[model samples]
Target chain A: EAGVAQSPRYKIIEKRQSVAFWCNPISGHATLYWYQQILGQGPKLLIQFQNNGVVDDSQLPKDRFSAERLKGVDSTLKIQPAKLEDSAVYLCASSLGASISGANVLTFGAGSRLTVL
Target chain B: TQLLEQSPQFLSIQEGENLTVYCNSSSVFSSLQWYRQEPGEGPVLLVTVVTGGEVKKLKRLTFQFGDARKDSSLHITAAQPGDTGLYLCAGDPAGNKLTFGGGTRVLVKP
Candidate 1:
């Protein structure tokens, strides 16, 4: 089976520039998540979508970070006017939404590494 | 507020050695999950512990959940180089959202 797919394995952009990362989740998965992971730290949830409807995005920096999972299959995370601190790996994951035990199993794709100058 | 804290931010040991990583939190969670992430990759789920005081073993790795449901640990026996990765513990506070710990980077030298 094909795992989650993310485009542009790596990207380099100057500060204040705009960049976007795309993710194709696993088939039949109803839940998708976008996470930001800084070097030497764990991934932090930036946004979550449940079948095209956003479930949570409280941690997302609305001023600069935005994400959308249109049609509930693929997702895109965009950072406008990227900041130097925005340089990090952006990870996309998906899961079957069910019970607590069932929902915690997340299948993640190789992340998109971004470097902002 | 970050709900999870992992101890020993980094670990480096030779093959065949044993090591343990701890995840502590004050907030009680319905379930806790452990993930292993390699450099340049996203985190991969290793185990999920729901019941308090539950213990699960996966080959050379063992995961234990605290009775209070606010803590967890990962233990590796006769660790191999293949076990080298960043270990992270995540707690589900609610609504399918996860709070991740700081992560512990493990390096098992061959």
Candidate 2:
């Protein structure tokens, strides 16, 4: 079975520049998520989409970060006027359903590494 | 905000040795998940414990959930170079959204 797919495995940009990462989740997965992972740290959720509708974006840095999932399939995360601290790996993940209870199995992409100098 | 804390941010050990990582949180969770992440890849699920005081073992790796459902631990027996990676514990207290710990990076030398 095909797993989550991400593009631009690596990205390098200067501070104040813009960058975007793309993610295509597994077929039939109803829940998709975007996470920011700093070096030597665990992944932090930037946004979550359930069938094209956002479920939670409480931790998203709205001023500079934005994400959207179209047709509940592929998703895109954008960072505008990026900052030096924005250097991190952007990871995309998908789960089979939108279960509100118990443990959900998530399949993640290889991730896109972003470097802001 | 819900927070999960992992201890001993990094660990280095020789092959055939044993090591344990801990994850703790003040809030209760319905379930907890453990993941292993390599240098360039996203994390892969190692195990999930739903019941309090639950213990699950997969080969040389064993996971235990605290009785209060607020903590978890992972122990590796006879570690190998292949075991080198970041170990993360996560929980979802507000339904579907998962909150992750800081992660423990383990280096098992051959």
Candidate 3:
């Protein structure tokens, strides 16, 4: 019954630098997601992965942001040449990947807080 | 992108007070979830309301979905210090994609 796990609980870097966050979802979970949470806003989905394939990534900043879930167990979210606006908490979550009509409650990680100077 | 809006961005109440937070959207969703988050942790799911006009209660907390399926509300009675946190509402537009509303930060002072 371990929850989702993420690395680097806090990160500080200068603008134009690249940063990456890692996540390990709960055991047996088949769906993973990456979200960006600003200072006073809710978590915004950046991308979603159903197994090894991506389900949705329309909100991701393609020019600077990229995510991969190799083998569908672990995930990595990267931002190149980060901007000041990119400073936010990066949260990772996982679910059972069941349909909306089914039971698929999400389990979230503590999140990695990024501070771009 | 579907937009979810939450009211009273911030609220502060004394212990034993009752408060309600709302989440609204113009677009319909298949399901909506409510979560509460502390300062340093990710959000924890509080409840999910799918059926329109459905009411679910968890202890002193009550969640209600609008008849139109585009809105939801969370009511807390006899709030305590442990109730202080950020409340977020997220709508599932599709099977796995979620759209979140700007959260409501509640502070219950003892």
Clashing residue pair totals per candidate (backbone < 3 A) = 0, 0, 0
Task: Provide the TM-score of chain B versus the true chain B for each model in turn.
Answer: 0.97, 0.97, 0.96
Question: Comparing to the true complex, what docking class would candidate 2 get?
Answer: medium
The candidate maximizing DockQ is 2
Per residue, candidate 1 scores C-alpha lDDT tens digits across B75-94 of: 99999999999999998877
lDDT of each: 0.92, 0.94, 0.92
Question: What docking tier does model 3 reach?
Answer: medium
lDDT of 3 by residue, B1-110 (tens): 33899988999999999999999999887778999999999999898888999999999999999999999999999999999999999887656577789999999999
Off by over 4 Å in 1: A99-103
lDDT of 2 by residue, B1-110 (tens): 42999988999999999999999999999999999999999999999999999999999999999999999999999999999999999999888888899999999998
- Supply the TM-score for candidate 3: 0.96
- Please give the DockQ score of every candidate, comma-separated: 0.74, 0.77, 0.70
Model 2, residue pairs in steric clash: none
TM-score of 1: 0.96
Q: What is the lDDT of candidate 1?
A: 0.92
Docking class of 1: medium
User: TM-score of each candidate?
Assistant: 0.96, 0.97, 0.96
